[model samples]
Target: MSESRLHLHLHFHFLSLLFLSCVSPSYFSTTNPDDNSYVACGPHQAQVLTEFMNEFDSSHCNLSDPYNGVWCDNSTGAVTMLQLDDCLTGTLNPNSRLFMLHHLRYLDLSHNNFISSSLPSKFGSLNRSYPKRAHW
Candidate 1:
């Protein structure tokens, strides 16, 4: 397989493992990793998330804000879930930093005012079952 395909394969594997794993409700309940004694969110993962957030006009939102949340795997230090709602304002481009989050299993961008933005085909690539829509 090509390098890109290999990368995609590994990415899919990682996401699959994350999705299959059962995490505690308390894990998702914490908005700040600092609140916990053990560091779950890796510095690099946090930086990527920060850069992704910077792509939009999220001046009103912060990492610890109630409207925005980030969950990271303690074992892998990879971001697993992101919830950014009602606080972002910008266009989501095809090459947005948001797509750099290969480890993300859950993403919520609800009630955001994104102007003239359309879901890029890459968004569909995230789900292996997404192509099944054609058969249905």
Candidate 2:
């Protein structure tokens, strides 16, 4: 598929899952960007996130089969986890799209090749911004 169409398709599928996901009563608010939006997560939200993801390099881990490498909270459509371990092989620079997932509570980038690059200082933003109950 064309890059634009592929992105749109990914967004559509992601949104479908988000909307279809079950939400708890305590997390049913749509006014905060920290949480998923009632309308859409927007292109700025999961665009790069999905673009940088693909099928795992190995098919041994079916439990983590999502080719997009993103897991969402559904009710709010906010990304909660990003497991991109051995799935992707690339360098994540300071401006990498991984930083865009502000709501992420669990991020696993282990077991992959970062090309010996250092984690960006900007990644510190995730420290304070991540909501409570963060886990990986």
Candidate 3:
């Protein structure tokens, strides 16, 4: 497989592991090295999510880390909701890294400027485990 495909595959599995952590903890062990690293959400996703959060702050619309509008799980630092509705971001491009947030269950991209842009097809691939509701 190509490098991009590898990333997508890893992203999918990593997200699935994260969901498992929230649902079935038996199969998702943070104490184990291999299992722990599999769902780490690492630097790439952190960078992407951090950038997205900074770019799309609902209150101030400023770019800052540790910003508001990010809801992460306590047990897992994986981001589950990016509440960016009523944000000031101008547009979402086809290549926007937002689709990489596979673990997200509540994404509020409404009221943003998606002019001339449509949601990426991969966004449909994102899913949440049982009991975790997904709302756009």
Candidate 4:
């Protein structure tokens, strides 16, 4: 092969590797058992769970998960948790919220930099499905 063609092939392979590394889920950690960074609280204590999370540093800690370093209490069946605190300044992808909310019963997005315009109109559905309860 020509030298220029060989160099082009090598560049393409490198770019592909870089893209895969950034997008691969395995590159991030899942909120599963044996992953000790976070713990799963049961569903009945959703209120309490949210209260407790409010005290922590909710900034994206570079976690492997797409929730951007946020953790969850996945012990309650398949319920997931997403917390967006003041430290969050960037626009959040709507698709990410949809995916995380699929099996979630509790979400704490308080204190974030989110604007009403950035939120989806269907966001009301989240409240309907997972009604906020008093902290236990």
Tell me the tens digit of each residue's lDDT in model 2 across 45-67. Answer: 45544443331122222332232
Over all chains combined, what TM-score does candidate 2 have? 0.52
Model 1 per-residue lDDT at 104: 72
lDDT of candidate 3 over 38-122, digit per residue (tens): 3333344466564443333234243232323445443565656554443333334446556666667666544443333344566
What's the lDDT for residue 37 in model 4? 53
lDDT of 3 at 1: 45
User: What CA root-mean-square deviation does each model show from the true structure?
Assistant: 12.5, 12.0, 13.4, 16.5
lDDT of candidates 1 onward, in order: 0.49, 0.43, 0.41, 0.37
Worst 10-residue stretch by lDDT in candidate 1? 13-22
* TM-scores, all models, native as reference: 0.61, 0.52, 0.50, 0.39
**What is the TM-score (0 to 1) of candidate 1?**
0.61
- Cα deviation in Å at residue 114, candidate 2? 0.3
Give the clashing pairs for model 1. none
Clashing pairs for predicted structure model 3, backbone only: none
Top candidate (TM-score): 1
User: Which sequence of candidate numbers ranks them by lDDT, best first?
Assistant: 1, 2, 3, 4
